[model samples]
Target chain A: MIEILLSFSQATGIYSFMNSPWGWPVAESIHFFGLCLLVGTVGLFDLRMMGFAKEISLADLHRLVPAGVAGYSLNVVTGIMFLSTAPDQYIYNPAVQSKFFFMLIAGINMVFFYATTANEVKSGDAISRVLFRAKAIAAISLACWCAVIICGRLITYYRPPYHWCLWC
Target chain B: MPGSKLGLLKLETLARLEETALSTWMRESGFAFFSALTVHSLAMAFVVGINFAIALRLVGFAPRLEIAALSRFYSLHWYAAVFIFISGMALLLAYPAKALTNPVFYLKLAALTLGLLISRHFQATFFDRPKVTNDRRTINLAYVSVLLWVVTLTAGRFLAYTHNTLLASRYF
Candidate 1:
């Protein structure tokens, strides 16, 4: 795993850029802005699915999903850049590992949501059954995303236990 | 006295607050500080996230959605705001000098205040005045609200990076 990460980092040229005075700070700022966009849109949609804002049509609320996707895309790009810059810092960090775990759960939950619950809600078939399913999925989505954010913040506090070998 | 008269007064007040048992406990207790940080971050996400949804609606992203329907979220927004405010105060008490001395801190506070005001103003406008159309003015306010949130979040993040003083005693 370390060897793969080392090779990947070597292949990328973002290190020098990330090491620049403005690069990391600017990237961090963008990362946070993207976080707000993602959480705000996606989280609100999940709340709606869970029957928070019942007055707003599910279809209309789903329209905001695209903005959430954009935010997620921005974070993924920035996240990869950060990894490319310093693979060792994240690869061996427990917090990063947990963050990835939560993200994977969120991704799977999202797929499940779109496959079953979203369709059920959109088609207006078996409203009660779909509402129950949607509520469960929404709860899971919210929990996973919140966990992801918490773990992401914890990364800075928990570093890799081992010393870095640049040539490893 | 070398600085502004108000600066001295503020420093003295902060110093006294820092010596209080509550402040000391908030600072020295590991769990308390960590919990407060977590609450602050989570609350920020909710407040910013809910506000973003409303702002996006106002910007005409979801024209089918009624403004009145979206107003249902304002209560959630306010709830999160209250949590953020309480957690934020705990954090400030923990390190009053760190935040009080930073310009970015003031910027974050200003942005938050303005963002909340804009949100309240628009909510009232949308709910109270039934005839107000989703015109350019409404959209403009939405744009401004989002901008202010961006500023507020950025400023809050920069506070960690930009602080030069951790306590009033050391600096003053």
Candidate 2:
């Protein structure tokens, strides 16, 4: 099934992007820039909630959230381009699998923040508590993202066999 | 082993440690080593980038907030940096020979050191003094810190292109 999908992708000339001399590098550069902008904006907001930049009210700090969201959006779009170009190669790869799983956990972590912490943030009295949860989420996000990058790098080394080969 | 043998072993180690894309490409250890390197670079952007941004705000360039409120951001920055360091160490272990011998790696270490030192100074000098807002010195330092981090990151990427051994030798 995985091979069939990969062949279809290949037949479509999807992976041809890798053939371009500048394609991979350009994608990688953009990916990195997105990471910086994402961290910068979200991190600023988190710092505000934590009382590091206490002068800035939550409402003011909240402005930076959109920038972070934009960064995330860039990553999502570019990330898809990377994965689509090589389906089986990534789907069966262990490192990619691990990265995807961790990313899901990170996503869920964000959901918890939105579901539970969002109200506390609006209430205004719980800046300290909100800060704690925000920090936790930020930290986890960073870790999972790091894992994702590592796994992505490992794709070459952990190239999936076209078929499962059992050995003892 | 005698002095000559000791020298030979050290030479061999240096040769092995040389940073070359081909060496990285052809390393026999399988996926673990390379994966760690990719993770390290990714983690670096987050940790360093976030830290620099917060420091800039605290220094007064982004004057919208009181310097003290950025603490949460700083804490997250530190955590991200630490994660990168741990994973970075794992990467280093996988290719101790190459990393230790590579000049570019040394450059990265130096840049990180200098960057961190400036960050510490900014934290102590400006951040501690709540009254000190919009100081020119702080802003200047913030600019320098950001530049240093960019250099560090770029140098890290260029390691694939610049390492002497990659061009000089081939890996099988």
Best by lDDT: 1
What stretches of model 1 exceed 4 Å from their correct place? A1-13, A162-168, B1-12, B128-132, B168-172
Candidate 1: the clashing residue pairs are: A40-B49
How do the residues A120-160 of candidate 1 rate in per-residue lDDT, one tens digit apiece? 78655647877888889989999999998888877876776
- lDDT tens per residue, model 1, B112-133: 9999999898778776443556
iRMS of candidate 1, Å: 3.3
- DockQ, all candidates in order: 0.54, 0.27
Q: In angstroms, how far off is B65's CA in candidate 2?
A: 3.1
**CAPRI grade of model 2:** acceptable
* TM-scores, each model vs. reference: 0.89, 0.64
